[model samples]
Target: MRYIFFFFFVLLTLSGCNKHEEPSSNLIVSSFKLPPKNESAASSDAKDEMAAPASPEIPQKIIKEASLRFETDNLEDTFNRIQSAVTLNKATIQNDSEGKDYNNIYRNLTIRVPSQNFDAFINAISKGVSYFERKDISSQNVTEQYIDLTSRLNTKRKLEERYLQILQKATKISEILEIEKQISTIREEIEAKQGQLKYLESRVSESTVTIEFYKTIAQKEGVKTSYGSKIWAAIQSGFYSLSEFLISIISVWPFIIVFCIFAYFIRKRFKRKKK
Candidate 1:
């Protein structure tokens, strides 16, 4: 009975110890012990409003520009459409030539076409030719170029405006001269860029097409000759030869006469000395 009472007393002591050592279930535990909210509701609302969706950023004015080189075998057809292409593309023929050898006559032409219709224009041009001698199609993505031009132009324009304003406010002639000089230089640069843009626009507007063709040698139809006609031609040629000979002799008659007179005098002097 004493052993059972001691066992019960030991169990009660363990239970009381466990109750004292137990962790509080209501106590909050977290890895990140963050600070309490100090920001006002309006401030939090403003932050929420400022946050934006993860939308892909769009580029401004995506410019399309390119250049190409193409060669064709059917030069005739190529030439025919070449003018039209130039007009359509606002371009010009850079080079064109046609020549003949003993056997053949070949034609060569270099043309520039527009960039907007570069591919479509090339397709149209290819259809006109028999076959391509060589098709060298290339593309230079000039989005960067256009963007660069725009930036440069904008900056230069602002500079130009500033210069104009300075010109208006100038007090001294020297200052005016210096400003004018600077303005001139800026204008020259602007003109150069404008020219470049025009050229690029023209290139993009038109495609360059180089055309070459060789004419095939054809057989002679027939050989016809008459004996009477040949004789007549010979007679005419002989008469012309005789007239030329007579004219040549007559031309030098004065010199010939002088030589003969000198010769006669020398002979007479020799004969007199011998006598």
Candidate 2:
């Protein structure tokens, strides 16, 4: 009876101790205490501010491009002038080509310049040019596109950080793999957005200009075709016609011979009748 009573008392004491101590789940909950009403309201405001980020000031981004085609009497002089302008504007010549067409000897240049000096370079090139066969200037605004890419990139970076944090806390290999996959996807998106942003920046920073100038062939040689050329062409045409006639005659030589023999017999018959 004494042993049973001691066992019952020990069991009761253990149960009381368990009731006094906090459970694992409640201990976790108690670690983070609720703030007062005023503090809570301030925290909520802070969260609202964080959730809605302020819009960044976006300077206007413009891509400028121009193309000009004209006629120049002296190619060397005009090219020298353009080179001077290019030097003054700190421009780079991407491509320089000279070719002769049917009626003109032309030179084409592709130039890249700083966007800030685009106008100055254009004006410098236009100083001595009296006429242009074609002149085109275009401007494109990419501010919105740039801002969008930047925002998306930032968001992806934040998402990747969150994924990394989750990966650290993960215990199972499957969970880790899944989190890593998500991180990889987010990283790819971030890289792509960064690339787009870089492209936009490059375009905005640099401008492209294409210039084509040509000297007309008529200035050097007034006549397109001389009388001798016309005579030669006519002779060539006559020779070609003669060649075609010979080909036609040879194409049906047997039929031609047959017709000739029949005509000869008929003529002889007529002559005999006449006699």
lDDT of 1 by residue, 179-227 (tens): 9998899899888888877776655545566656565555441123456
TM-score of each: 0.46, 0.64
Clash pairs, model 1 backbone? 113-206, 113-207, 114-204, 114-205, 114-206, 114-207, 115-204, 115-205, 115-206
Give the per-residue lDDT of model 2 (tens digit) for 82-200: 99999999999999999999888999999999999999999999998998889999999988888767666665666577678879999999999988987888788788888888988
Model 1 misplaced stretches (Cα beyond 4 Å): 1-96, 128-130, 218-275
- Cα RMSD to native, each candidate? 15.6, 11.0
lDDT of 1 at 11: 100
What's the CA RMSD of model 2 in angstroms? 11.0
Highest-TM-score candidate: 2
